[model samples]
Target: MTNNKTSEVPVQDPGADAVSESVIQLIRQHYTLDARRIRRIYAGLGSRNWVVYTPQETYFVKEFISSEDAQKGKRSIEVATHCITSGIASPSTVANRAGEHLTLLEDGGLALFSYVHSDEQIDKFSIDMMAAAGVNLADTHRALSRYTAPGEDETDEWLDMDVAEIVETVDEILGEISKLDQTSEFDEVSRRLLQDRKVQLANYSRLIEPIRILTRGVIHGDYGQKNLIVDDTQCLWVIDFGSADIFLPAYELGRAAFPPENFDHDDWLDRGLSMIKSYALRGALTRQNLVFCARAWLVQLLQSVYGVKQHYLKPHELQEDLDLFWLRRGKATATLFESLEEVEASIERIL
Candidate 1:
């Protein structure tokens, strides 16, 4: 479940005793900093890691769950760097130490990164911009498919596992979460998500299995505009490879199918068509494969349900996402799954 921890506004420059001091120190020392200022910006997926602001730059510092697991995460980032340099866009890694991606601070963990443009969500993203992202993402996947994981890759952790484990874990947290006096609605929402998840478990697994095995490569487990930056020149700079992996093509393609806004029905088929066209520019698009891709999109939607269930999202949030999710799906269903297929055909005919 999501950390319902009371919001503690982070100090502009918290001291060494703050949350991850040892790791931060190691990172600074690795950078050979004479000592200036280090500020904690936000907590990342891993509690031990953070988005840090140094005097002259920004970085992602990750403290290992333990030194034993250190190499696994470190190697993942190292491989991710290869993926980025190979053509995928990712936050550049400027340094590495102790087999990890960043300096190993005395406190714990490691650090790595180069400064990136600020993450301010655009009010409106042009179709051209999204098309560019689709193309970029496809090129990245194709490049990564050529390589295999390092000996210590952590990308395999979530593979071949049933959805039951995640559901059980989320269900176990519900009672404890409800004990907190936040609001009744959140608890209610959590409960319903749990129930919906119980029914959807088998369906999720079946849908995921085919694509998971078909498009196995270094997959970006997470892909969204939040981790992407479009500069003044419209060059898309992708960041945050913390969840890159070897997984399904459907996963990545489904993610690219949606535009930045809350999912909608109107023009989605056209949107999907454009997105796929961008991805398959020099490649062939088969009718059979695109149908599988449509199913993959549905699987991705259900995966969100799994996430909401596990994260204990508020009922209102779940409702909002569900509405958008179905809206997008509704369009695909209406088009008889030919939106993307038609786009491919149009391109083929043109060629």
Candidate 2:
């Protein structure tokens, strides 16, 4: 969901040099910052981030990439605020002097936040951290429940999508790849992966024909390792509510608990178990939630092909390595999808 399209705003610098003059003016006017330091930072999934320094405090600035629907931006910040008010340990979006969460740019939006200090970059988390993340997500789900509930039409938005149409999309992607110059091995691997995509996508549909009805709600859509940060005290601060949408909580839980990178890890099962037990401590997860996560997860991995499309077709918009990152994750997920029943039963054991 985060790896979708690109949006154009009136900005030039893409690196650590300096923010555009218009953005600087916006900062000065909206934020009332004098002569402090500002520098761009490396953040992905379609948003640009910066760290602003001042005499009293440090602040984090984020540039919303898409402005086509400004209401979406409003809803995202509202969700983030709701998450914080519900006692979730997340970075809070600070309102401007005029009491607005979002300051729309010429074609995009700008938001200022209280900077979260994180001294460590967690590559892999321990079981305790896993459980903590699970509990945090549960708390977040419960928090969002107060703001709004997802509508009935949105329940099948993910589940009822036609696999055949997705296969056709894959074919179009393949045809585009075939026309490329084929510079390196990544190009070759992409071609092979798309071939896998067409067949397995149909097979996946047949195997899980009647996708189970899932627990539906508006959630922190991209709740993965990338969006999670660890501070000096080892507390996990969930960030990035821009991709917030209607989704199955268990589907998201399954992806986080049994991610493809850790699917074959020796303690993968135990780690997932810890997460589930922690989440279910307050009975946030249902029996249907437990049973359908794997199937939904498989569908997500196969069908969420925007990252691949952006990387291959729209080359300059994303990093070159993103193709490999997504392709590898997709392949691993397909391998795990073959054992979907085992995964379902294993996770259901905690139920």
Candidate 3:
């Protein structure tokens, strides 16, 4: 649940267009591909993306804005390739004419992927897809567990946090949001949520419990709505094996199954546990592996303020972005903090 790396590129991201003459030439020459049409799509931060159509088929293209992102994208491509070979339901990477995942560019880089079509949103929380999501995530973890990326020994996903420092950061952002003019809707909502979170942070310490037994491995970095597409048959297609190097099952399960939208549902806990239990059954995991989940997620929610910084502090850097996502996440964090005791008790009883 960590924030993305800070990119040092220009504010004018190359997210506008990829169908220019020179770019088309690079795509055709290196990958021997012709684009019938290219439409820009938002995949994630740090990339210019397009859902493209060719005379033959459809595909997705991602172009990174910086060298650092390009390199991480390459590694993720490697991991996705491995996932496909291991029988995971991920899109296959298309190599350029030179037989590499990336077609390197002057300022950034581009990569192509087979297209995935979906008829549903995970927001609907369809009964069939929830269980499928669990199995999909479990299978992904099982496959990545055996894979160690190039020049890597071991990876740990446990968050390193100081309670006081996080509280202070929260306080700082809250105070900053307080001084806003409140003319905009985001400013109004953010101010109220910050005030609520400040009160909740006082008791957040009660949720803390120390742990020693830890398990860590490669993780599917982003398993949320953006990457998970439910096709017409309702099979969960996991995509975009992000630059995630390490993860803990407890944190990720809470992150994936207990989405922000689920908090509003009356049976949120049941749905979350259903997904987690399904994952555990498919992956053959034990109770101890998931025991610390409540604490793991609690700490993460406490640390979340990426939205605050993006909205209130660095507004200039903002583009056509996921504004609703940040607000939903902030609201969910408040709900969880208010219900910490029930959340922890439920996880303990079930797991």
Which candidate should be chosen as best, given lDDT against the real structure? 2
- How many steric overlaps does candidate 1 have? 5
For each candidate, C-alpha RMSD in Å? 7.0, 4.6, 5.6
| Model 3 poorest ten-residue lDDT run | 1-10
Candidate 1 lDDT trough over 10 residues, lowest sum: 1-10
Q: Each model's TM-score, in the order given? A: 0.64, 0.85, 0.85
Model 2 is weakest, by summed lDDT over 10 consecutive residues, at: 1-10
lDDT of 2 by residue, 1-351 (tens): 122242223333454233445555677788766526665665565567766666788777777677853456676777787788889888877777688888876677888887878745454456787888888878888886776633233556666777888888788888887887654676677778778777677676565553555667767777877677778787778887754566778777877777765655667667777777788786787877766766777777887676677775676544655765676677666666677767778777777
Off by over 4 Å in 2: 1-21, 121-124, 149-153, 179-183, 207-210, 242-244, 260-269
Candidate 1 lDDT tens digits, 164-220? 665666566566566777756545655565555556555666555655544445666
| Sequence-dependent TM-score of model 3 | 0.85
Q: Model 3, residue 64: displacement in angstroms?
A: 0.9
lDDT-sorted candidate list, best first: 2, 3, 1
Please list all clashing residue pairs in model 2, or write none if there are none: none
Whole-structure CA lDDT of model 3: 0.68
